[model samples]
Target: MTPTPIAEPLFRPEDAVPMSTDEADVLAWPVAAEQLATLAKYWLATGRASGRPHVMPVMGVWLGSTLTVSSRPGTVKGRNLLRDGRCVVTATTELGDLVLEGDAGRVTDVARQREAAAAFVAKYDWRFGLRDGRAYDDSLPGSPEYAFFEIVPVKGFGYGPDGLTATRWRF
Candidate 1:
C-alpha cells in the first residue's frame, strides 16, 4: 500500500532522507503480509520508567497490521512494556528493513489471544499453553507464566540499505 499516513510520528534517525510514494519501491514496506509471515525475529525496543532503553530480540507474529510478542512478566523487557506502551520493533534481512514505531499494549481478548497463540506456534515451532491466550505458564511443566503484547504501528519505515531511499507509512 502506498503510505497514506494516519499519523506520522518522528521516524528515522536524524540524517535519513524523507521518502515519497512516487519513488521506486526499493523495499516493499511498512511490511506486507507475505514479508511479516516469514520473518523469524524482530528487534523490540522499549523504555523503562526512568526513560532508559531496553532492547531485545523477540519472537513475533504479524497478524494483519498488529505485531504480537510475549515474555515472562518478571523479565526486564516485560516490565518495560508494562510501564511504558511506546516501543519500536524492527525486522531486517537481505531484502530490506522495516521499523515499526508505536505503542504496545497487553492482549486482553481471549479470542485474539488464541489467534496469537496459533500464529506464535506456527511461526516459532514452540507452544506456551492452551490453558489461556494472553498469558500462561510454559507448555512444559512448572514453566513461568508469560505475558503477551500487541503493537500496531502509528508510524513506520521500510528502506533500502543505502542511505538515499526509503518508504514511510503511518497509521
Candidate 2:
C-alpha cells in the first residue's frame, strides 16, 4: 500500500488587505494584553555579518507602537542590529501569533530609553523579584548593559488557525 501525501496550506495574498492605522489599533490590543506577557519567550531575529540569520530569545516591551528590547552592548544580537539595523520579531499566544518586521535602531534619546526601561520594569516586575516585594529599578542610567533597541515596525502580521492578516503602518 502506498502512503497518502498530506496537502499543504495555500496562502492567497490578494485575499487580505494591507493593514491601516485603524486596523493596527484593533490588532495591537490583544498583543498588548496577552502577547507582551510572554514576549521574553520569543526569539528576536537578526542578520549575521556573513549574511545568515540568527535568532535568540530576548526580553522585550511593547510601548504603544514601538517594541523595545534591552541587552548588553557586547552581545551578538546587539552587534548585529547596530551593523545591519534590520530585524523581525515574532510573538505567539494561544489566541494567535504576532509578527513584526522593521528596522532596528539604538534608542540614544535618554528620555525615550528611560521610558522603555520603565515599561520593561512594569511588564516583568514579578520576574525581577517583585512578585510581592518592591519593583526593580530599571531606570538607572549608569548600566551599559541596559542599552535599549527600538524596533520601529513598518509592517505587522497577525495569524491564527483561521487565517493570516497583514497590516502596514505609517511611521
TM-score of each model, in listed order: 0.80, 0.65
Runs of candidate 2 exceeding 4 Å displacement: 1-38, 126-144, 163-171
Q: Write the per-residue lDDT of candidate 1 for residues 1-171, one digit (tens) a residue.
A: 434454322234454336433344544443344676588888999998888898999988877778889888789988998888899988886656778898888887888888888888787867767464546657667876887888878877766675446666657
Q: After superposition, how far is residue 19 of candidate 1 from its true place, in Å?
A: 8.7
lDDT of each residue in 1-171, candidate 2, tens digit only: 222222121223454344222342344444433565555666789999999998998888876666788766568898999898789988886656766678888877766766775777687762221212222333455423445788877655555534444333233
lDDT of the candidates, in the order given: 0.73, 0.62
